[model samples]
Target: MAELAFCLPDLPDVRDFATAQAVQSGMSEEALADFLVAVNEVATNAVTHGHPTAKAVLRMWSVGRVLVVEIHDEGRWTPETPPGQTPPAPHATSGMGLWVARMVSSDIRFETGAAGTFITMSFKV
Candidate 1:
């Protein structure tokens, strides 16, 4: 597995780095696009909603045909439901990041506690 630990200002760089790694690891074109979108959404949420001065850690690996990416943050924020489980109101605009992540990834898991929040997303390569 490869990992990137970053601060808020490093968000864009991390996105590009993750995408490049995914491509090198053999993710298909279509899957790469989806993975990029998903990772961006999660990483953005980590920086914006997480505790002040929080940092994020992103890890990735490929097991056979599956590509897994995990994003973690050292923050106390916890969602009432796993992101994307509930659809926001029609007029809502800001809460859809996790929803989009869920739609693009093959599977997603979350863990939150006093330590922080961790989001693991898997994709079919």
Candidate 2:
């Protein structure tokens, strides 16, 4: 098991640390890059639209044949299943971050309620 916790601010430091940690964990260069991108998208969304004073917590662990990454934010944002069958257009620049995360990771889930919002992703090892 490998775990790290940090109260990341809405700044560049958040992205840097996420990239470093993923790379240090022996994740493939490509996997690490994808993980960093996904984590940043979630963190940025929390900072931008979730709420003020939001803090982030990240945990990574291995289970059987899979590696799991979980990110939690102290904000009241709910995750909804986009009501569509088709993915966003390739030319679209926005509204595709979460879609990308789901595509790269084997599994991605979001939980939200009065407590907070949490995003979890898994990759096959």
Best by lDDT: 1
Model 2, position 55, has a per-residue lDDT of 63
Q: What's the CA RMSD for each of the models?
A: 1.4, 3.1
Give the local distance difference test score of model 1.
0.85
lDDT of 1 by residue, 40-106 (tens): 8899888887767767889999888888888988876556766688766798878888888988888
What is the Cα-based lDDT of residue 73 in candidate 2? 69
- Off-target runs (Cα >4 Å) in candidate 1 are none
lDDT of 2 by residue, 1-125 (tens): 55554454544766776666556556787677777777777666655655566566777777776667787767765335542224789799777777778877888887888777777888765
Native-to-model Cα distance after best TM-score fit, residue 104 in candidate 2, in Å: 0.7
Instruction: Note the residue pairs that clash in candidate 2.
Output: none
Colliding residue pairs in candidate 1: none
Could you estimate the TM-score for every candidate? 0.91, 0.73
